[model samples]
Target: MTPFQTLTGTAAPLLEKGKLMSNVDTDMIIPKQFLKTTTRTGLSKGLFHELKTRADGSENPDFVLNKPAYAKAGILIAGENFGCGSSREHAPWALLDQGITCVIAPSFADIFHNNCYKNGILPVRLPMDVCEQLAALAGGANHVFTVDLATQTLTTPDGVTHAFDVDPGRKSNLMAGLDEIGASLKVAGEISEFEHKRRLMTPWLEPAI
Candidate 1:
């Protein structure tokens, strides 16, 4: 996973009436038509493509992401069950490709949340009221927000702050830029020691080189 330090950028509101519509699934995030490629490149264009386009293929100017103020948004504040569809790593990849570094939501699907962490996207689970408040703040003109992973705090442009929680192991992995394999490699010395002991204890099972 790419290391995440602090992310400071404009945040967009993916909510309605101070709340986000629930069950914003992975299919809705990238849609089935855009899932052809395994590569992460060019996935940004597929992000919210269906929602941002009409049947006639014209842009939907009313879409939050299509709005001028949110075009370059890096943080997305949403509601419950933010990612509640198929278990696909591509979902987070698409969001990252669009420059969305963090997502603040009331809740998220288990698989989706794990995928987000693996892909270097911070998936914050705040209370519903807190998410609503953050969403409202995100609506301000060009409002900027900072997510400090080290401190586990989110600071808004108007000086308001919110504290959040992240699993210590996950936090460490993100901070150290280590994926699962990379994290395991951090204990390579211990692994070698274990192997040596195993070889000595079970010499009859050893294979000839």
Candidate 2:
């Protein structure tokens, strides 16, 4: 996972009929069909698969992400309860693959929120009104937004800054680009030393083979 310090780029607003859409579940982000692969790469093609695809399997140009200006959007301004439903890690994988490094919403599913941090995606929770403000800004011509994890602030395109709270441990891990496995490896030396002492104290426990 890439270390998340600061990200400044266009923010795509996931809206419906000009209003922010709520309850965006994991299946909507990346359908079950795309969950077959354990690898993270190549899932971008399946990102928002249903919403971005027409009945005839053609591209839905109307989709927020399919639009020309938002095609490479690195930030997403969404509604409440984003990333709801199943606890698939592939949801974040697909988002990351699609170049979305930050997701701003009023709230998020607990499991999905944790997965975002683990996968280098910053999931920002703000008041619904605040999120709506950001979403409105994102829909305009100047839709760029900046998310600084170090500062724990999100700056809108018009220079308004909003603060957010994150767990210190999660913040630290993100800044260091340390996932669960990477964080465990950071204590490898201590683990090895403990194992050596344990074996010295109980030689009989060693395998005969």
The residue-by-residue lDDT of candidate 2 on 47-135, one tens digit each, is: 98989999999999999999999999999988999999999999999999999999999999999999998899999999999988888
TM-score of 1: 0.94
lDDT string, candidate 1, 1-209, tens digits: 67898999989888655457688999989988888999997998888887788999999887789988888899998889999989978899999999998999989999999998888899998999888888778787647999999999999988988999999999999988887889999999999999999999999889888
Score every model by TM-score: 0.94, 0.92
What are the lDDT scores of the predictions, listed in order? 0.88, 0.93
Clashes of 1: 0
lDDT of 2: 0.93
Question: Which 10 consecutive residues of model 1 have the lowest summed lDDT?
Answer: 13-22
User: Candidate 2, which segments miss by more than 4 Å at Cα?
Assistant: 197-209
Clashing pairs in model 1, backbone N/Cα/C closer than 3 A: none
